[model samples]
Target: QQQVKQSPQSLIVQKGGISIINCAYENTAFDYFPWYQQFPGKGPALLIAIRPDVSEKKEGRFTISFNKSAKQFSLHIMDSQPGDSATYFCASTASNTGKLIFGQGTTLQVKP
Candidate 1:
């Protein structure tokens, strides 16, 4: 089973600041990396993603970066707002099995 380790169980960011969360994977076989965000009482939603072929991917205020050699990745939230406060999760998956291994999770609070 593949495992993912995430840092900073919780984070506090000011509005219009940047929020960063990191994850490291144990298996080299994992090919896809994605970050999910979930609000209170809501299901996790795909925020951004990166594959082995790309070093980084950005969508609006969200960015995800991949380091293939290090088997690690990170999610950055730019111009973070109070609405951005939520629980973030980093996950790894292989193309074949399609099994997602998720990190412990990080709760972010974007203060105004």
Candidate 2:
């Protein structure tokens, strides 16, 4: 139930286009959800996050839409650039244990 499943193992986008990724989880205990972006040979870094209390959150060109009842969430990258190419992972954390469960990554590539 704690597992987060992400789709589209790979994605290709034209520069300045939009990139979208989806994720779902079954764990009701999960209260904190975060998205991380990782570059090759580096660790993942927090991109944006949304809690169950919020339906959506946006930061700059990045946005996260969450549905508590559906146990689903999605990330949208606007004006995607070649530099945005990287592996993105969606993760969930339960309040009690703070244990984080991550979804399989989606590799996004933006063409010039």
Candidate 3:
């Protein structure tokens, strides 16, 4: 079974708008939750991350809201710009093992 599930395979937003993507997991053993952003012809880069202990974390326009009780997490982009358009992925890893399971992906397009 897939440990994680993501919604809205694609999204579109206007410049200065907000872009949101969500993910859910069933594994309570998951301790590390991270989001990655990838651009065309580039490797996925770590965007933001939050542990189960933390409720939320934000970096500039990027924010990750985590719900440990619900076993879900979501990413929000504020004032999304065209340059921010990229494929975002959410992943979880267990502490006992270094195995990371990733969500399918969400392709975001920020229109200028």
Candidate 4:
């Protein structure tokens, strides 16, 4: 199984601050990297993603920083809010495999 290691099982951030979550993968075959956010009693949804060729990708207040050579990636949430409190997961997918190898997940709490 492809293993993706995520750090800081949990995190606490102040509202309007930045929230960061990191992940590392062991498989080089993994091509696509995406971040997912899950709210209480809700299914996870795609937050943002980055391709191996791109070092970084940003969408609104969310950003994904990827390091292809290091097999690592991270999510950055700017101006984090209480609504952003949720379990975030980082995942990798290989081309045409339709399978995602996800990290353990990081639970974030944004304090106002």
Please give each candidate's TM-score: 0.96, 0.97, 0.96, 0.96
Tell me the tens digit of each residue's lDDT in model 3 across 14-110: 9999999999999888899999999999999998999988898999988899988889999999999999989999999988886789999999999
Clashing residue pairs, candidate 2? none
Q: Backbone clashes in each candidate structure, one number apiece?
A: 0, 0, 0, 0
The 10-residue segment with the lowest total lDDT in model 4: 93-102
Q: Tell me the tens digit of each residue's lDDT in model 1 across 7-110.
A: 88999999999999999998888998889899999999988878899998999999998898988899999999999999999999988885799999999999
**Model 3: clashing residue pairs?**
none
Q: For every candidate structure, what is the RMSD over all alpha carbons to the true structure, in angstroms? A: 1.0, 0.7, 1.0, 1.0
Q: Which regions in candidate 1 have their CA more than 4 angstroms from the true location? A: none
Show the lowest summed lDDT stretch of 10 residues, model 3.
1-10
Global lDDT of each candidate = 0.92, 0.95, 0.92, 0.92
TM-score of candidate 1 to 2 decimals: 0.96
Q: Give candidate 4's whole-model lDDT.
A: 0.92
Off by over 4 Å in 2: none
